[model samples]
Target: MGDWYSAEYPSSSLHSLQGYRVFISIAMILGDGLYNFVKVLGRTIFGLYNQIRDKNSRSVLPVGGRTSSPTDSLSYDDQRRTQLFLKDQIPIWVATVGYITIAIISTATLPHVFPPLKWYYIVVIYIFAPILAFCNAYGCGLTDFSLASTYGTLAIFDFKTGYMTLASPRSMFVSQIIGTTMGCVISPCVFWLFYKAFHDLGVPGSQYSAPYALVFRNMAILGVEGLSSLPKNCLTLCYVFFVGAVVINGIRDIVGKKWARFIPLPMAMAIPFYIGAYFTIDMCIGSLILFIWEKIDKAKADAFGPAVASGLICGDGIWTLPSSILALAGVNPPICLKFLSRKTNARVDAFLAS
Candidate 1:
């Protein structure tokens, strides 16, 4: 067993190690470092803007109340806190710059491991990064990160149409990934703001499902493989579905909110197809429960329904963290009930026999 493990597993283990390192470098180090840098920068700029605006407004204020004294208008503690926060960000800036420099040097030297930095790739990244970032930020601000998959799909479509013929698959993949990553990194400001707002209202950050990373991963796989790998029929169906979705959305916009209940949301219609029946059924059941509750006692439901729903959603999300940690540690807690196992196995055996 030891000999077999040593000989056969080494190559697989090495590959896994390499993949893990790459993932850590790209997703955790680069992505998170960039996010922190941008977040601090945004916070500093906004803080300065608010301070200046307040000072300017105070200068014109009529002598009265708290505004009578400039020092009283802004507390010393608050000023100290702001200064401390800004001072703390100095290291983050240094770290971000160092990480970027190292990443550039590594990419230049080891293109096979890191993303390539070709001239065309640079141009593509420059052109699409801001556009994707804006759309992603806007979408996340308005809704949740559920729209990330849609944004990613749109980005891929744009890239394929614009640069597929001009660049190699690897180049296109790297550029698109970088563009999308930039969008995700910069858009965290909106997400963080919403997260804090929800947190203040008793919702945990985990309750806010940001499944865009998973969507980005899936799309990246598809991008690498190319459309030619897909079946002709599947491609045709996708085109037809795209047209239908566009038409449905157009009608929804034209009709507006007056007939919103009557019109189906394109996302709502499409999500079931992608995620499948179990999640779709769960969502429908939840919605039905809410609808019935609202119908029964409008005022009571309006008052308490949100709190109850938030608790349930947040509970599930909170539990998922520990569950995930346990899973990573190879301690998967059994979810199945012992009482149901016999009946389930019997049914399965009977079906198989049939």
Candidate 2:
């Protein structure tokens, strides 16, 4: 999804528009299709196997107060209602037609938002949309993995190589946006997976950190401008630091678990270079507290620690929404801590004099 958004922004026409459109369309279809097919096949086979296994197990059990039978499982009214619901469900063809109409409208009315639509692009989308939807649903049902961003990245890279003539910065950007938008539309997995992963974990979407966005933005700028844009000394230092970090991590891994604890994590050492010291300090403090708690009572820490950590995270995130609204309205929240208060004796005296 990020890949697609990145490609479309500040568009440059380095690549063939038609070639990119087809490439993105086909890549999205295949990647999503394969994922879905595997998921559905696995689920159906396993589901049937489980049903059979359960039936066999139940049959062998001695007749008890409660018997496992079709009649006992669901009442006639319940089964009838289910059948009616299925029968009344919207027809596949009708839904497909409606979706296609919406796509056509979107392409026609929102040309600036969407890429220029060719007949082939529309055809490819219509043809593969069902397949993508099935795959997304199946994959999500099984593992809750959304392939939108993953496949979008593949599409952009594939276009860069396969349609080199059309792979200009502008063309790639448009292709990415189109592919990502289509993927999000086709895949229900993206929405459900986000809900399950974040909401269920009590993590607010606003508070979710996107470190990769920063990396990608920098990479994109470097790709366009070339390495000469960066100072040679700074570039050399980056190379040295990267290599040094890798070597240290390698040694730490080889030294095994006991010695690994004493060695500083390469990521921990490098994070302060990119992130603010204040944030790094907070994380280090939290990690140290967790490490100490785990050492003292491993079992209790293992069981209850996650919940406590989640509460702290949620507390930080939950207040952000109202705080942001208040800030936007030019009303800052009061600072309750005296040490942090900006009001001084001089200010109080001046106010009294006034």
Candidate 3:
């Protein structure tokens, strides 16, 4: 349900969207598994395709191209062909080990295990380890062996605290300041623009029956719903708005179309299967191990890590647990049902008052 795309993209520029769509399409193809599959597949398929295409077209070689006679035949080095696999492959392995190990350790060592692990820790691990590993791999020539020792130590330390441990305090502060500015200022304005524009649409009565009504209503609701209620629809709304916006804008830019078709797809109409499945899997994994871990160490049950874990119970786990319950009953989350109930009730009451 995370945003896999964005809006405000240059909708009239197909050339620009080519790059963006490639990224978005690949993300659609591979989400969290992106690192493992996308990189490998791109290198393999494209490399092989080019090699065969070139081999077939090689009746004539370029002026300076090497031509081999019987005695001077080119010797293919099979080891060199495998060198891409050797290109800091160990560091990728080590960093991957670092991420998975840290996730497991963070999961295992966390004090309270009732709720679940926080995404923030996973975020920090992914954010830092890869950058450090890349630097060590290609930039500074640091050995992959050193990467695990250096970055792994930092990751473990960061898990104890909420922030990355290896980054300089000054850099962290600067980043925090910049991030705060964006969230507090820029994000609100972006939301407000969508709210007012969609609110202006003012779909009357049964017109809310269409797919666009879901988009229209949710945008208005998200821009106003209580913080408590917002999370319920936020995941689906966020996914639809972001992806639909990207697609609409991409097509508009590519096709040079007008803005009239920028309607949000219906949430009720789209398959809620993926999100239901995701939440189901998350709950199964969390429930299976969390209680066992909690029982094993009652002494450290409320430690700092566990405290953070408890906080996650308040966030993602909020809807996650309920979604699991509903899924168990063979029901998807009634996103459109809930929206219609609230919005329709309010409209009816307003008519009565008038």
Candidate 4:
């Protein structure tokens, strides 16, 4: 990866890891997908084998109840839990027809709506998407991870969280729609408030850069230009690293998981490229706190860890609005605390004492 980047774009001055990041990220995603694919395929074959071997083994709802999710492999015996999760499902035909109608409308309107995406592309994506989506959901059920935006990789929404909290897709959808509608109405005002609070708007090197705009613009460019526009050797390196990642995943699987546990997950390691070290440092701090809490009281930590995490995530976000208000109001702290070298500290202490 380093060699390819240095050779192809040697003089390109950008982010510290910009040269290697994209190639490494793609490789990790491709490799992880391949690993999950093989595992799923093996399980499917085994399931088929069991079905053929014995008529009694044919899939049937247990006497107590059926599982809520198709991916709930281990929940078949948890009859009471399954029964509770089972809602009066929206009619299958209604779901099927509604989805088909929406898909058809979307496909028919694509040329007018989004000129870059031909109707055929949508068809192709949707055709393959179902298979991948199901696999992704199943993989997510097994592992609490969601690579939602990543195609050809394992991904899912939080099915466990949804079931635990909402218990109904209908309820979730209604709530989601309501929240989205409200956000659509309110977000512009919030954006304007921040605009007023922060002097530099849309300036390069500003911390408040509109990253989503850049992301969407880049995606649009990629869609319009397609693979032909990729950097000279980038496409070639993508192929190389993708294969390497798959090979590494296969090797890990072949080796006992106990020993292979030492190996870092490709998907996880790739995260630093997008999010950088700030969040990683914050996570480490949170983890240290959790570790201490766990030592202090394992039961409480086990029970409240998720709740505490959710609270912290939400609570951290909300302070921004109040800070923005303060900024807009021209409020300033009376005294500022500053860290300094020994000489600077002594001078400051002496000045304060005087």
Candidate 4 residue-wise lDDT, 135-235, digit = tens: 44543553344444533222234555555443665555566678778878898988887787787765555656664344445545656678555445656
lDDT (C-alpha) at residue 97 in model 3? 87
**TM per prediction:** 0.42, 0.36, 0.22, 0.66
**Clash count in backbone of candidate 3:** 2
The 10-residue segment with the lowest total lDDT in model 2: 10-19
Residue runs of model 3 more than 4 Å from their true location after superposition: 1-44, 48-90, 111-228, 231-236, 248-354
Residues 278-304 of candidate 3 have per-residue lDDT tens digits of 434554465456566668875454233
| Better structure of 2 and 3 per lDDT | 2
Question: lDDT of all predictions, in order shown?
Answer: 0.49, 0.50, 0.41, 0.61
Instruction: Please estimate how well model 1 matches the true structure, expressed as its whole-model Cα lDDT.
Output: 0.49
Model 4 C-alpha RMSD vs. true structure (Å) is 7.6
Decoy 4 TM-score against native: 0.66
TM-score: the better of candidates 2 and 4: 4
Of the two candidates 1 and 4, the one with more favorable lDDT, higher being better, is 4
Query: Residue 244 in model 4: shift from native, Å?
Result: 4.4
Ranking by TM-score: 4, 1, 2, 3
Which whole-number lDDT from 0 to 100 does residue 281 have in model 2? Answer: 70
From the highest lDDT down, the ranking of the candidates is 4, 2, 1, 3
lDDT, candidate 3, equals: 0.41
